[model samples]
Target: MGFSAEWLSLREPADRAARDGPLAQQAAKAAGPNPLVVDFGCGTGATWRALAPYLPTGARWRFVDNEPALLAEAGRVAGENAELVEADLGEMDALPLAGASLVTASALLDLMPEAWVADLARRLDVPFYATLNYDGRMSWAPAHDDDAAVTAAFNQHQQGDKGMGPALGPNSADRTIALFEAAGFMVLSADSTWLLGPDKAPLQRELTNGIAQAANEAGAREAASWGRHRHAIADRTTCHIGHIDILALPTGNLQESTHVLR
Candidate 1:
């Protein structure tokens, strides 16, 4: 339950991205004429809000998530512009919306393995106008590059397997690229890196928790190693950072394609 109500209170996803240069540029590239934008894993609808301006006016957004509390909060945040679905990805399976354009997810993808992506892409009717997902990109402040021993240990720890099948925070970017291409996508692939300085608290905190989660999970088998990190994060004296690979690909070009113009 790391994604608490307190986390949502800290800031809006829109404002967080507005303040970030690299993310803003990538987001602009994802904009244009997407009519029915489906945001998978749309927690609190913050990701939707961040990409809302880019979608066509009078367009409706479909947000899917399994958490009722999160979906309810998203409903409250999104109002009329949003259609919240409180079920798994299976709830509203992907089927080309004929003219409907694009599918987006932020800070997801990495958690899932290749099979899930394949199924979703097939359902969505592959070759999405664009897709951007970020993950485990939590960072700590007063970052100590000099703390190599702890940091390296922590980096390896964070990049370690999350028992979710594939190692998410480690090398997911490459896997994502290959999967998309294999699915018949003409992809624009790039790594989207988010660096947090002390000024940005919410993003910074998210990074912090994410790093702590990774490290904790990574080192769970070793109690002594795990306990040390748990204590340090509670004390709040470290910094963390991570990256997500961004991809923009056309769909139905290979597996199947469709166009939606507003």
Candidate 2:
């Protein structure tokens, strides 16, 4: 389930546009001044770039990823204030969380199992901010007959093991909220959908390809045909992909948890 830097770079703009800005602002405020933030699965530092401007001036960032190349690129992009740590998120027990004021991840939770997420929730005592978690809603303008089948198959594929046991897929946001709440955290969530038009042809094509691949892997017989048709009309089509941004603060302090976005 490794993603190339090129693919991550391609999706950066849409990712930025789709994230909940107000939620990020709330997270920044909740983190306090000069917070030390630990970002998991920080691919190419897009999440860092998206949140850095909203956070305090002297805030420190620790970017954790298992990919060395991505870590290098993140370090280069995030400047000297960022410390890159190469570690496997699948093995969360060994992760270092010392002195962290906030924990964050983007496009990550949906790929993990419920137990893993619960473990993370139990371990994290600080405020948590996660964005771009897939909510399983995919729509296309100028719809085709095979759209539903492909989407269903892809969603099914999303639930299969992705190195962390059975993934939560579209159920991630709700599961995350419940997990954190059970761990004494107050959670707030917001919709962060990606609306792709002709202007985003590259991302559209990549997304189509990825979906088709997943559907095919899930044993959808018409996936290849659907992919070909989608690619042919992608330049003229629009796609709406759903996601969620969440912020969780420890429940003890009502004042700090009250600053969440509605």
Candidate 3:
């Protein structure tokens, strides 16, 4: 399913906050001076904004996305040092990675199949920084009876084809780590959970609706009622959604390897 610009915009702040800043810094440092960074599924260039400050001032970026509107917004957000490439990531074999110092994607892996990720790992010899992959942990304050049922159903839906074959869903992070490791890369990971409270009611509401919809579609009989009950208490509730941030360093250079934070 295509994500709307509005939804991407709405989630930018939380996405930024939930990423691993130190890992990003390490990735930047490892890229050397004037690194060429290629970002996949880059929506509105949020990844650029999140990592630019920690990178070299002269760092150049290439933002890739299939959606023209998002590419336009990415150009605006990423400014003159950035170039935009409009391409579908589902077409894995055709993905461009030549001369890239680092390859990055945010909240994207979970939507891809295992084979696609393996192919990507084998294709790129550069270090990779991927963030916000769902890790299967979710919690709601003052838990409801149907929370488990709804969550299970939603996760089931997540594994279904999202135009990229069968999605890895919560298994994306582990799959990525294994793929990179098998390719001889050194990988590190950290938690980047979203802790949402009343202040983020809008995001919470949107998430609730999305989960409910996905659950219902996945054949959860209690999904509709669960959605209504969650919405009723959303204003006063807090949520914790788990995610993982991974940095995979290219093998072969010990001197450059020191740049990666353990």
RMSD of each: 6.4, 1.7, 2.0
**Which digits, one per residue and each the tens of the lDDT, describe model 2 over residues 1-262?**
5789999999989999999887888888877787999999998899889999988887899999999999999999888899989898988876768889889999999999999999999988788999999989999998989899999999999999998799999889989999999998889888999999988988888899889999999999899999988888888999999999999888753333333443
Between the candidate structures 1 and 3, which one is better when assessed by lDDT? 3
Worst ten in a row by lDDT for model 3: 253-262
Q: How should the candidates be ordered by TM-score, best one leading? A: 2, 3, 1
By lDDT, the better pick of 2 and 3 is: 2
Would you give me the overall lDDT of model 2?
Answer: 0.89
Regions more than 4 Å wrong, model 2: 253-262
Give all TM-scores, in the order shown.
0.67, 0.96, 0.95
Top candidate by lDDT: 2
Whole-model lDDT, candidate 3? 0.87
Question: Judged by lDDT against the true structure, how good is candidate 1?
Answer: 0.51
Badly placed stretches (over 4 Å) of model 3 are 253-262
Q: Write the per-residue lDDT of candidate 1 for residues 1-262, one digit (tens) a residue.
A: 1256556655444234423344333434444444666666677877666666655676677776777788788878778877776655533344323434556666566556556666655555423422334433444443443233344444566444444454344445556666666666555544444444444554554544454455445453333443344344444444334454344454533221232111
Q: lDDT tens digits, residues 1-262, model 3?
A: 4688999888888888898777777878777787999999998888898999988887999999999998999999778989999998988767778889989999999999999999988987888999999977889997998899899999999999988789999899999999988988888878899988888888888888999999999999999998888888888999999999988877852223333333
* Rank list by lDDT: 2, 3, 1
